[model samples]
Target: MMKHKLPPIYFLHIPKTAGSSLGQLILCSYPQGSQLNCSLSQLLQMSREEISQFKCFAGHWGTGLFSLLDKEISSITMLRDPFERTVSNCLFIKRIVVKKFASNPLALDEVEDLKLKSDISELLKCTNIREMLNLMPSMKEQQSCYLGCDIDLNEYLGVSQCSLDTLDKSKEIFIENIIAQQLSSGLLDINEIFNKAKQRLDAMEVVGIMEQFNDSAHLICNSLGISTPKNLPRENVSPENLALGNLTYRKSGTIPDDVIKQIDELTVCDREIYEYGKKLFNKQLQTEKRKFFWFKKMFKKSERF
Candidate 1:
C-alpha cells in the first residue's frame, strides 16, 4: 500500500471565538501530525534553530505565531463580535480563574477577593461607550494576572504589595493610548509578525467572522483539492453567552444598549470594518433567499405544465 500524506492546515485561534470547536473539526479532517497548537509559551522557550522546523500552528497566539511558522501553510482564524468576546472572556475568568482561586485558600485572600471583585463590578458598571471600550481589556488583563502564567509567587501573595487599583488605572491609560494610536494610524503592524512566519510558511493569512464559516471552509477545501463535507461544521454561540438587552431582535439576537453604544463610538476605521462585515452578512442572506425563490419557481412551473 502506498502511503498518503495530508498537507498541513494552520488554525490561528483567536480567544473566545469558538476556536476550540473549529480546531477539533480541523484535527478530524487532517492526519494527526499535521495539526499544531501554537499557544503554548513553552514552544517559545525552544532554541531558535529548533523552532524553525514547526509548520502548522494554532491557538490564542496574540500575533506572535505569525512570525514563527512556514510561509506555505494557509493560516485561518475566526472572529466574533468584540462585545460578545469580552463577555465570554469575563465568564471564562469567573469560572476558571475565580473558581480556582477560591478553591485554594492560599490563592484567595479575603481582602484581595474584595478588592478584585469591587474593581470588576466597577468595570462592569461602565455605561459610557468610550469608557466601556477602555475598561474591557483592562478588566480582562486583571483577570489574566490571576490566571496568567507570568505572575510569580511573590506577585501572587500579599508580600509583594502590588496594588490592583493602581495597576488597573495604569492599564486603562495604556490601553486607551494603544487604541487611540491604532485608530489614528489606520493600520496594525502585522508586518513584523508576518515576516517572521513568512520565512518558514509560504502563506500567512487570516479568516474572518464566524458568520462566514461555511463559505470560508468551502474555499479552503476547494483550494486544497480536498473533499468538502456536505455538512460543513457551523460555529454556535453558546446559550450562556447570548446577548442580553435592548438591541435584541427576534431573528438577530440581542445586544445590550450599552454594547451598541460602545460599538457606535468605534473609530472610523473600526466602524468601516464593521459596516463591511454587515454588508457581507446581508448579501449572504439575499443569496439564500434567491435560491429558495428559484427552487419554488421551478416547482410551480412544473405543476403548471
Candidate 2:
C-alpha cells in the first residue's frame, strides 16, 4: 500500500506523560531529515523558511510555539493521571537527588535544607501542599502549563523559558527553571492558566491519554493516516529499583497519604484536564470507528455490485 501523506506535526510533549513512547512512534512514522527534536530556544531561532523544512517537531517547548505554527501542522499531546503523573515525576527527580547526594557530599546539605529525609519513606513528606510545591515549583499545574501559553512568545523567547539547565546547577533550582516556562504567559493565577490550557486542548487535533497507550497510539496514527506500529516504545520509565542501595520507591511502594493528598490538591487543573482529555479522546475514537464502519460497509456493498 502507498503510504498516506502526513501533515507536519508539532508534538507538545508534557513531561512524564508517556511522551517518550509516543515520541518514538512519531519518530518511526517520519523519514530521516524530516524529524526535528529540539529545544524551545532552537525552535524560537528558526525562521519560517527553516521551520517549513521539517514535517515533525517534538519537544518540551510547550504551547508558545502555537503562535508560530500554521494550520498545516497538527498539534498533539498525551496526558497522564494527574496524581500518578505527580508521583512518577517526583520519583524521577528524587532519583537525581539520590544520585547527586551519593556523588557529592555537599549535595547532602541541599537535601537537608529542603527538609527531605534520607529514608525512602520520608522522601516526599511535607507539612502541606504549598511546601511541596515550593520544593518542586514546576510541579504545580505542570501539564496545563505545557498545554497553554500566551500567543505572544516575547516572554518565552529567552533561554530560561524551558531550559532544563537548572537540573545540574542546584537541587534547590533543579526543576525551578520549568516554573518560568509554566508561567510564560505571565498568568500567575492557576485557574487562568488552566482555562487557557483547556482552550489550547480544544484546539489540538489529538489529545491522548497515557493510560490508554495503544488506543492513543492508534488515534495518532489514524489522525496522521499512517499504520500503527506493532510495538509501542516505553522510554524514560521510572525504574523499579534505584541505584541508591536497593531503594524501592516507585512501583510496589506506597506514596504517603498526605503526599498523595497534596499532589491531588496541587493538580486540580491538571486533573480536570485529564478528565477532559479522556472525554475528548473517547469522542475522537468513536468518530474514527464510525468512519471505519462506513468505509467497510461501502466496500462490501461495492463488492456485491
Candidate 3:
C-alpha cells in the first residue's frame, strides 16, 4: 500500500460486523503504533494532529467525523444480512448486561453506561414488539449508524436539511422516537431511508459482505495491497457457558417466526440494503481478482526486467 502511496484506510466498523476479525487484519498489515482503535468518545478527545498519526482508525463511531475523510483517506466497511445482524445484536445486548451484573457489585444505576447497558438488556429480553420500540438504530440500521453521513432524510422527506453531524449526535434517540411514532401511527417511510443508504454503499471504495467473508477479504486485500487473510479470525464469539467470564455474544439461534417477522418489519431498510450490497459484492470480487492477477504479473515482469 505504501508502494502505491494509496490513501490510508478508514474502517467504519459497525458493531458486530466482523470488526474484531478485521482488526486482526489491520494490526498485521500496518506498522506498530500506526493502527488506532478508539471509541467515539476517545476519538473526540484526540486532537486533529493526534488522529493524523494513525494509518487506521476504527471503532463504533457514528458519522460525526465524516468531514475528516478526504482523497488521502480510503474508507471501507462491511454489512451483514440485516435480519441476522439484528438477531446477533439483540442476543449480544442480552449477554453483556448479564455479565455486568455478575461482576459489578454496585447497583445498576451506579454507572451511567451500566444503566444504559441494563436498558439494552431489558430491550432484548422483551418478547413483544411494543417493548422493543426503543431499540437503538445502531442495531436496526447499523450500516447507517457507522456510515451516518451517507443517509440524508431531508433529501427524501423534503424536511429541514440536517447534516450527518446532527444525525451522529441524535440518530439513536431520533430513530427510537421515529420507530415509536410510526408504530403508533401505523406508517413509515422506511424505503426512503434505505434508498439513501444504498446510495452511500454504492459510493464506497469497496463493500464487504459478512456471509461471503473470504471473498470480501480477498477484495479488501487486492484493493489496498494488504496480504489476503486465508482465515479470517472470529473474535467475541458466544461461549458455551454464555453470560460468564467474557461477554458471550453469538450470531446463532432460532428466532421465533413471530419475532422474526417483527424484526423484518422493523428493519425493512436494512433488508433491502443488504440484498443490494450482496449483488455489488459479487461484482467487486471478480474485479478485485483481475486486479490481483494483473498486479502480480506486473511485479514478476518488473523483477525480470
Candidate 4:
C-alpha cells in the first residue's frame, strides 16, 4: 500500500480569529521538524530550499505571501463576525496598552515616533471603542486587507533584511499596519480589495467559521486526511482582562447601539466578506457530510462481503 502524503498548508491567520487553536491542530498532524511558524519577514529570509522542507506554514501574514511561495500549498483561514472581531481587537489592544504602560509610564515614551506616541497616548485616553477606532483608521476593513492585498514578490525580495528586522521590532508591533498602508495610500479601492479577497477565499481548501469551530476543525482534518480529535484546543481567547475593567469592553450587551453602528460602518467591507465566507462554509459542510455517508455505506458493504 502507498502511504498518503498531505499537501503543504499555508494558514493565513487573520488576527482575533481562532487561528492559534486551529494552528496547533495543523502542526500536530505533521511531524516535528516539518512545521514552521514564523512572521512574514522571517519567512522571506529563508531560501527556497529551506522553506520547502516545512509541511506547515502558519502566521499572522496576509495573502501577499502567496506570490512568494516556491510551491503550491493548500491555504486555509477562519472568518469571524466583523463587528465582534473589531470590538475584540479594540479591547485587546486597550488591555495591552494599559498593562504595558502601567508597569512603566516611560514605555509609551519608548514607542519612538512622535505621531505613534501621540496615538498610543490617545488610545490610552479613549473612553470607548468609537474613540479607539477613530484613532486607528487603518483598522477599518482590516479583514479584507489581509485577504485582498497581494505583494509583488520581487519588491519584497529586494528589501534589506535589516529593514525587515525593524518590522519585527516593536515599531510594527500592535500599531503599524503593513496591509493597511496600501489601502490608506489608495493603491487599491476598498471594493477592489474586497473582491480580490473574496476570490482568494473562494479558492481556499477550507474556509472555517469561528462560531462553528468544531465543525471547522473536522473539515480541516478531513482535508489533511487526519483523524479528528475528540476535543479541539481553544487558544488565545479574548481575555477578560481586568485592565479593561473600567472600559467594560468585553462584557456582553455593554457596547452602545451607536458604537455598534460605528463598527458596522467601519467593517462594511469585512462584513460582506464574512457573509460570503459563511455561505462557502455551509456548502463545504454539506459536501463533507455526503462523503462521510458514502464512506460508511462502503465500509458496511465490505464488512458483509
Candidate 5:
C-alpha cells in the first residue's frame, strides 16, 4: 500500500497583493518545511516524495498552475478589491517605467511633452493585457519602459502630431485586439476567472481577504487545530501613503467617463464578477458573525451545563 503523504500548504500569490510580505510571514512561521525560492511551476514539476518534504510552499500561482495540483492538497488565496488592485498595478508600472524615463536624458525630452492619457494609451497598445497574461512579454519589457519591440513609444514621440493621432488610433485598435484575444482565451473575462477562483476557494480549507487579514489568520489557526500565535507580521498601508501624491499610493486612476461607458458595454463578465465578489463578501461576513455568536453561546453554556 502506498503511504499517504501530507500535501504542502500553498499560498497562491497574486502579484501586488502583499504576497511578498505574506510569504515572508509564512516562512517565518513554518521555517522547518518551508520552501520559498522556487516558482509554483517548479513546485508542480516535483515528485511526490519531494513535495511531501515541504510543509508550506508560497509563490505566485498564475491561472495556468491550477490544473497541476492534486485534489488532496489544500490551497489558499488572498484577494483584494479589483479596482484598487488595478490602480496599484498601474502605479507599480509607472514607478518602474515613468521614473526611468524621467531620469534618462534622452527619454526626458519625449516624456516632457507626454500627455498622461495618450502616453498611457500608447503604453497599453504596446504592452497589451493579453501579452502580460500569457507571460509572453520579455523580462526587459516587463521591467523597462518599452512595451513590445513593434510598438516603441520613443520612435512615435518624434513623429508629427498628425502621426501621433494616427498612432493613437492604431493603439486603440491593438487594445481591442488584445481584449478580443483575452475574451477568446478565457483569461480576460473577469466573471469566468472569479467563478473558477471560487471553485478553487471551495476546494481549499481557507480563503482570505486582505481587509480581514488578522481575523482570517485566526480562523485558519482554529481550523488547523493549532495554537494561535500572539503576533504575526502586520503591515498596514500608512495614512500618508494612502493619500494621493505619495509614490506608493496614488488616487485611484479615473477610467475616463467615456471609456468607462465603453468598458460597461464591452465587459459584462467583469461587472458580474464585481457583483458576485460584493455578494460573497457580505455572505462571508454574516457567516463569521454567526460562528462568533455560536462560539460565545457554547462557551457560556459550558460553565452551566
Candidate 6:
C-alpha cells in the first residue's frame, strides 16, 4: 500500500488579516524554528535550499515564493474585509507609536527616512483627511500594495532578492512606480493581479475568514486531522487592553466616510478578491461539516453553567 504525503505548508499572509495569530497556531503542529517567517529584509536572504528544509513557511510571502521551493506546497490563508483591515491597521500603528514614544520618543529619530514619513504619529498629526491623504502612499498604500499582489514587498515591485540588494531607485520612486504600474495597467487596473490571486487561490486547501476565525480554526484543524489549539477563538488577543483603549485606536478615530470612500477606491482589487475568497472559504468549510460539528459541540458546553 502507498502512503499519502502532505506537502510543506505555506501561508499567504496579508497584513492585519489575523495572520500573526494563525501563524502562531500553525507553528504548533511543526517543530520549532521549522517555520521560516519572511519579512521584506529577510526575503533578500531567502533561498531554495533554506526554504525547502522547512515544514512550513509564513509571513508576507505569496505566489512568488512558489517558484523558489523544490516541490509543490499546500497553502492556507485568511482575508479580512478590506476596509476593516485598513482600520485595524491604522489603529494598530497608532497603538505602536504611543508605546514606542512613551518608552523612548527619541527612538523615532533612528527609523529610516522613508518609513518615518508614515510613522503613526506623523500619520495622525495631519490636520485633516486631505492632509493625511497627502501623507498616504502612507502605510495604507503599503497595505494596498501588499493586497494588490494577492502578494507583496519586492514581489509587489516585481523585484527579487538578487535585484533588491543592488537596486538604484530610491524607496519613494519605487513606490511611485508601484502605484503607477497599477493605474497604468488600467484606470486602477488589477486584472493581472486579480487573475493571479484567483488562480493561486483555486489551488489552496484552506482559505480562512478572519470575521469567522473561531469556526475557521475549527475547520482547519478538523480537515488537517490535527489537535485543535485550546484558546479556540483568538489565541493572543488582550480583551483588557482593548477595553482600556490603552493599546489600540478606534475606527472612528482613524477613518471617516470620505476616507473610507477614498480607501474603497484604492482597494477595489482586494474587494474583488475578498468576495471570491468568501465563496471559496464557505465551499471549503462545507467539506468538513461533520468534523466541525463535533468540534462545535465541545465548545458549546459551558462548565460554569
For all predicted structures, in order, the TM-scores are: 0.52, 0.77, 0.68, 0.81, 0.57, 0.66
The reply for model 3, stretches above 4 Å from the true place, is: 1-6, 69-72, 104-135, 148-192, 240-253, 290-305
Worst 10 residues of 2 by lDDT: 166-175
Model 3 Cα lDDT, one tens digit per residue, 1-305: 34354447777676667777876676567777888776443454455566677887666554434544443666677888776677666656555545545465673443344334323334555433223324555455655434533322222231323443443433233323433344346453445455656776787777889777777777777677666766777777544324333322232333455666767777766777788888889888877778779999999999997
Number of residue pairs clashing in candidate 2, backbone atoms closer than 3 angstroms, sequence gap of 3 or more or interchain: 0
Compute the lDDT of residue 185 as modeled in candidate 5: 68
After aligning candidate 6 to the native by TM-score, how far in Å is the CA of 153 from where it should be? 9.8
- Indicate the residue-level lDDT of 292 in model 1: 67
How does model 3 score by TM-score? 0.68
Best by TM-score: 4
Estimate, for each residue in 1-305, the C-alpha lDDT of model 4 and write its tens digit.
11368778988888888889999988878888988887666666666677777888888767755666676777999998887787667756666555545556565554332224222324434554344455454358877878887755435553444554455444332222555566578898878888999998988999999878999999988888888888888788765523454343424555666666766887898989999999999999999999989999999999998
lDDT of 1 by residue, 1-305 (tens): 11244455567565666777666666666555555564233444344445455545555543344345445456655555544455555445444444534666776574244335422234355333224345334332211211111111111123223343333322222222333344347553433323332332223233346555666555444434466578866455544545433332222334456554553343222233334444544554466568769999999999998
TM-score attained by model 2: 0.77
lDDT of 2: 0.70
Of candidates 5 and 1, the better by TM-score: 5
Which segments of model 6 are wrong by more than 4 Å? 1-6, 95-189, 233-241, 244-255, 290-305
> Tens-digit lDDT track for model 2 on 1-305?
21678778988888888898799888778889999886555565566566667889888767656566554667999998887677667666665555645656766666565445433336555333335446555467788767755544544443343344432233222223555644554645677777878887888889899878899999898888888877778788765323423442333445566666766787888889899889999999999889999999999999998
Question: Lowest summed-lDDT stretch of 10 residues in model 4?
Answer: 112-121
Whole-model lDDT per candidate: 0.45, 0.70, 0.59, 0.73, 0.46, 0.60
Q: Report residue 199 deviation for candidate 2 (angstroms).
A: 1.4
lDDT of 5 by residue, 180-216 (tens): 3454565534444445544554555555555566666
Clashes of 6: 0
Q: Each model's number of backbone clashes?
A: 11, 0, 0, 0, 0, 0
Residue-wise C-alpha lDDT for candidate 6, range 1-305, written one tens digit per residue: 11233347887776677787888777666667777775544554555576678877887654556656677888888887776676555555544444534545565543333234443344445333233344333334333344345323334333443454564423323233445455556644456557767776677778888887877777666555576767854444533224535333324354355666766776676777788888999887776785568778877875536
